[model samples]
Target: DAGVTQSPTHLIKTRGQQVTLRCSPKSGHDTVSWYQQALGQGPQFIFQYYEEEERQRGNFPDRFSGHQFPNYSSELNVNALLLGDSALYLCASSLGLADNEQFFGPGTRLTVL
Candidate 1:
């Protein structure tokens, strides 16, 4: 989408490894949300960050952490990644927390080996 883009379009990691994914939000957007989509399933909310703080999180565990910079860009870090972590990671940008209109990035394909 025009408002959101992710880096390293694809990645490969092994079990027990850690990875960091990056996302740059829309020029005027102030919030970023991360999601994970496994094959044959809908995207699952991972977490949301705004104003440089994490305001909401989904069912993911603590191993999943994130940081939002002042520029509105954000990073998602997953530690001790498991095979189940293999999925498409998506980044969505919005104006505010849970905004009605969210521009989502194409997603970063992560395949765990």
Candidate 2:
């Protein structure tokens, strides 16, 4: 079975631009979560989606948003991007929120110039 997958292996943007990243969950996974990992830093939670609704969010601003589709795939949208937003966008998928096993994708490397 395939593991989680993300699109746009790399991206370049400028301040004030917007970007959308995609992710396909692993087989049998239903929950999707987004994270931002700055260079040399651990990931910071962006938000989580379950059952087609946003179930939980982290400290990120409203500009960061996401959607979960019926197929358990997901997309992350970032508006008014800033240089600070340059990082690896990671997607994680799990069977459920309470499940400890979460499979992660090879993150999309985003750069703001």
Most lDDT-accurate candidate:
2
Name the candidate that leads on TM-score: 2
Give all candidates' CA lDDT scores.
0.94, 0.96
Model 1, range 43-85, lDDT digits (tens) per residue?
Answer: 9999999999999999999999999998999999999999999
Which ranges in model 2 have alpha carbons more than 4 Å from their true place?
A: none
> What are the clashing pairs of model 1?
none
Q: How far off is residue 37 in model 1, in Å? A: 0.5
